[model samples]
Target chain A: MTGQVRTVDGRVAGRRGQATRQKLLDCLSEMLSSSPYRDVKVIDVARKAGTSPATFYQYFPDVEGAVLDIAEEMAKEGAGLTDLVAGRSWVGKAGWATSEELVDGFLDFWRRHDAILRVVDLGAAEGDKRFYKIRMRILNSVTNSLTDSVKELQAKGKVDKDISPAAMAGSLVAMLAAVASHQKGFTTWGVKQSELRPNLAQLVHLGITGKKPTK
Target chain B: MTGQVRTVDGRVAGRRGQATRQKLLDCLSEMLSSSPYRDVKVIDVARKAGTSPATFYQYFPDVEGAVLDIAEEMAKEGAGLTDLVAGRSWVGKAGWATSEELVDGFLDFWRRHDAILRVVDLGAAEGDKRFYKIRMRILNSVTNSLTDSVKELQAKGKVDKDISPAAMAGSLVAMLAAVASHQKGFTTWGVKQSELRPNLAQLVHLGITGKKPTK
Candidate 1:
């Protein structure tokens, strides 16, 4: 098990303290969804949490620190996305199903976590190592698994020798993520959700197997 | 031709005024490159431009307005991205060349304007229609041309019938944009620039043509 949660002042947080800390984090998260990340103030989060600013500082050093806490939890959950591709077959009908399901699961995960994910994206683009680490943790989980799949296919001579599995996997995963983040943009372009998933699935399958899906 | 450039207070900017305005925008752009968006204040931008905050205000209403001005100018140039895919043949060696050049050009464009593009992306993801429109202007230039290519290929029985041209084109373009924005991320993943370009070209060719490149 992980060690006990601690306050910023170096004191270990008990059950009650941990509960209060969680409450603050949740409030900060809600604020992030509604306001710009730069505008999210610690006192406002504390006020929304029905606690004093001092109580908040006891848990998090600042608004950014609290966001990192929430992102950490999300990354832990994101690591589970490895299931979408790991051990999945990439041939014929099975390949199509795997691709479709990976698209569905990846997009759903992005939608559920878009708010904090946006902040993490911005922070990463701004060259913050902490945010870059978090973004990498999430993308790396899926990309690494997909890379292994490609390498396996290559070893069996089922895939081209010239393809860099890491680049292919990373690009495909990045596409899924970029598409997921901008799903709304597609809708505005008159492309519905139903049309999107299949096309995305097709690209994913083609990128992996280098052949059209049997479906 | 576009209308004469005007300051926020209803005065058409003269030559010297236009020069000053451009200097402030250039300084603001530099500031965005080095500082977080939220932390960027008007005073800071003015100081960097060697002007007072009042002079900054005379030309633009606020920092966001200035950013919008910069984005607007960039969008006009970005519209030319259409040339990358418009009327490009996706057959045989020509298709591979088209894909490689598009990837190269797209990545280079993204790198040159990354700082402003990051803010535009964040604003669009935050649901700002102004930023959304600018982004759409750029992506649609490519996506529309690509969608037409897919549809033409499908009509000639060169591509599959099940493909949604718009969705396919949009997803592929989104992948390009995402990969372009995060090019540095790929390097950190141990994928070299040389490795990335060919792989991205392969995926683009595969997605558009529904077959592996002959290369």
Candidate 2:
């Protein structure tokens, strides 16, 4: 069972306190989307949330801390991404379907939480361990499953034995994450969304199964 | 012919002016690597360069403008990356070597300019047209070339014609950028650089040729 939420001052967040905290987080998220992360401030978040800076501090230590909270929530939701790959087939037309669905699902998830994810990415890139762990938590949800799928196929002589499954899966997942983050860049390059999806799925299929999809 | 460098006020930069301008850019680049992009200030860059903020203003309008200047310089260098694939054979062992070298070269370029590229990535993700254009200038140097390689292979009946060459090349380049940006993340995931590089090269090879490398 999950423990009850608590304020920064170590007091349990009652119904109203929790409501206020959620409001602050919502406002912070919106602020992040509209402005750069470094410019987000306690006063602005509080103002947008219809609260005061004192109330903001009562719930979270700082903007980074609040952003971490949002990232953690998103990571929990990101765990659901495992279903997109777990126990999925990597053979014939079924494999193509799995790859297509995985790209579709992953891109959709990333686009939805892009603002918070961007901050998290910057934090991790800056060598912040807290943000790094959250990023791994989210990506690993799908990566670990995909790694296993590759390993399983390799064991069954369907994939190359020399290939490192973890690295392959990690690279593929990184591609998905990178492509998802820069979706607009692709569009501007004249690659349509519909075209990008299948090409990515093709690469995924080729990487995992070492063959073109039957479909 | 290259034009003379000029100050923000439209005065041509003399030797000393250009020196001062270069120093400021170097200082700003250092500041970006050491701190969050949003927190990087003109005053800080000016102080770091041992110049007054007024002198800093003589050459560049703001941090973003200065960043674009650095990005433009990098993009020009990035155009040289075309040599990694232009007119190169993508068949048999040569294809594998090409993939390996491309991965190595692309990763090195990204790692060297990561601090600035991170800002570019953030800017592009935030829908900033200036940053997006700079990013395109850099990636297109490689993506456009790789797209041609894929199309060439498809024309030879080596790759599926149904696959979009641009999308495939774009995804592969995006993967390289993503993996390079998060090289530290991969290490933390227990994937060694030794294992990471070959796997990426393998994926690139597979994606481009629709077959495993001959190596």
| Least well predicted 10-residue stretch by lDDT in candidate 1 chain A | A32-41
lDDT tens digits by residue: candidate 1, A84-188: 999999998999999999999999999999899998988888888898899999998999999999999999999999999999999999999989988888898
Task: Write model 1 residue lDDT over B1-215, tens digit each, in one string.
Answer: 98999998898999999999999999999999999887899999999999999999999988989999999999999999999999888988999999999999899989999989999998888888999999999888989999999999999999989899999999988898888888887888699999999999999999989988875
**What lDDT does candidate 2 reach at residue B206?**
89
Clashing pairs in 2: none
Runs in model 1 deviating more than 4 A are none
lDDT per residue for candidate 2 within A167-195, as digits (tens), equals 99999999999999999888877999999
Q: For model 2, how does the per-residue alpha-carbon lDDT over B121-206 read when each residue is reduced to its tens digit? A: 88888888999999988889999999999998888998887989999999999999999999988998899999999999999998
Evaluate model 2: give its TM-score.
0.95
- When summed lDDT is taken over every stretch of 10 residues in candidate 2 chain A, the lowest stretch is A32-41
The most accurate candidate by DockQ is: 1
Worst 10 residues of 1 chain B by lDDT: B180-189
